[model samples]
Target: MTTWTAPAIDRRHEPYRADERTMLEGWLNYHRDTLLLKCAGLTGEQLRTASASPSTLTLLGLVRHMTVVERSWFRQRFAGADLPELYDFDADPDAEFNTVDTADAEADFAAFRAEITAVDAATAGRDLDEVCTVKRRDGTANEISLRWIYLHMIEEYARHNGHADLIREAIDGVTGE
Candidate 1:
């Protein structure tokens, strides 16, 4: 028997009948749920286990990284709120993923969920076409729309969920998010 367990978020895909914003957010939520499902029932140390040798990628790391992404995209980039990162990217560029060993999985997961909840609240009743100017890591300025943020987040979770799939299976022989 396979050892698959239900996660907190439903694994259902987005509904077919929805508007552009609804569809985009739906897909993003689905991918986010997929990533969480990939980590379900694993312990903190198990979460910190590296899937590929010499690569620091872990379920906990992914959760932490996405927490950073959600805060950056919704609070800072989309809503134009000037907020410092939860993790110091300048001092430790890869702190989110690299600091997994020291992280408490339960607290990190709660923080990730909180960020998602905050993002949803921030973007609610907002127009998708609203543009926000962002300064990139290389100091190049670019304007991006709220719609692009949704799409980008969807892609981000989807790509990372793929790695989560591999990592989870490596951990427990569990698969199918």
Candidate 2:
């Protein structure tokens, strides 16, 4: 029985000698891949293992959550694509994180990859200064820029990648940036 493992994150983010968009996209992609790299070499159940009691976080959950995030920011918000969220928020808030024990990790991984491609397509040929109206969590809307989205996504990945580090360590005793 072969256990599924996350692919290696071999590419490094661009540090210098790149334009603004190139640098931003490069960093974001690095973080995005970092999340998957953290899950490499783990079975679906292992990816579903929570770090500790009372926490529903798992690698699969993170994949689902980030998929939604990418869809929201790039497709829905930026591109003005009208679409419902991937997960049901009314019936089950935090469903992405809470309901991953039986979730298909490979499928979610594929979906995440697809969403990334879609996001890239949505944002391509757009200006960083181009602003879009985003509904905030507090029910207030504000005009935000593509640059902000890129930065927010980078930070989001960084934050989740931190969680991923701990989860991976707990799962198989593998650790590193």
Candidate 3:
């Protein structure tokens, strides 16, 4: 059987000057593409290769994680979509990361792309300042804005992409900014 490889990604350059919304979305997209670029052309086994001993982080795991993050923030928390967890975190807190050994890399990639589409649709036409109130486990309600979600997503992707850079480098010695 042939090994499945992730497709190539053409990341756009974020503009130096733009409106607030444009700047945030542009940087988010750039970082999103950066993560995929780090995994491009690698087979499923290669994508599942752990960074180092004791850390199960992998390119494929990051992809799964961000997919969950995208759905959790944009759909469940902000957009108020009633949805079940993508991966069974109850059964295993690190399900996404730990299940890579038998995961279908191609399907996971497709799901990630699909979640991004759904998140975009969910947030479309919503004002950046539009707020959503989430009930915490502690019985307190916290209000969050769409703008804050965007900023947080950018930070999440940026941190994971750094891990991806190292994992990709360890896999094949390919490195870049």
On lDDT, the candidate that comes out on top is 3
lDDT order of candidates, top first: 3, 2, 1
lDDT of 1 by residue, 12-82 (tens): 68879999988998898888888888887877788888989889999889999999999998888889888
lDDT of each candidate versus the true structure: 0.86, 0.87, 0.92
Better model by TM-score, 2 or 3? 3
Q: Mind sharing the TM-score for model 1?
A: 0.92
Relative to the true structure, candidate 3 reaches a TM of: 0.96
Clashes of 3: 0
lDDT of 2 by residue, 6-62 (tens): 565565665677899999999999998898888877887798889898888888899
| Candidate 3 positional error at 161, Å | 0.5
lDDT of 1: 0.86
Clashing pairs in 2: 5-41, 6-40, 6-41
Off by over 4 Å in 1: 1-8
For every candidate in turn, the CA RMSD to the true structure comes to 3.6, 1.7, 1.3
Off by over 4 Å in 2: 1-4
- TM for every model, in the order presented, reads 0.92, 0.94, 0.96
Question: Which is the better candidate, 1 or 2, if ranked by lDDT?
Answer: 2
Weakest 10 consecutive residues of candidate 2 by summed lDDT = 1-10
lDDT of 3 at 7: 96
Worst 10 residues of 3 by lDDT: 1-10
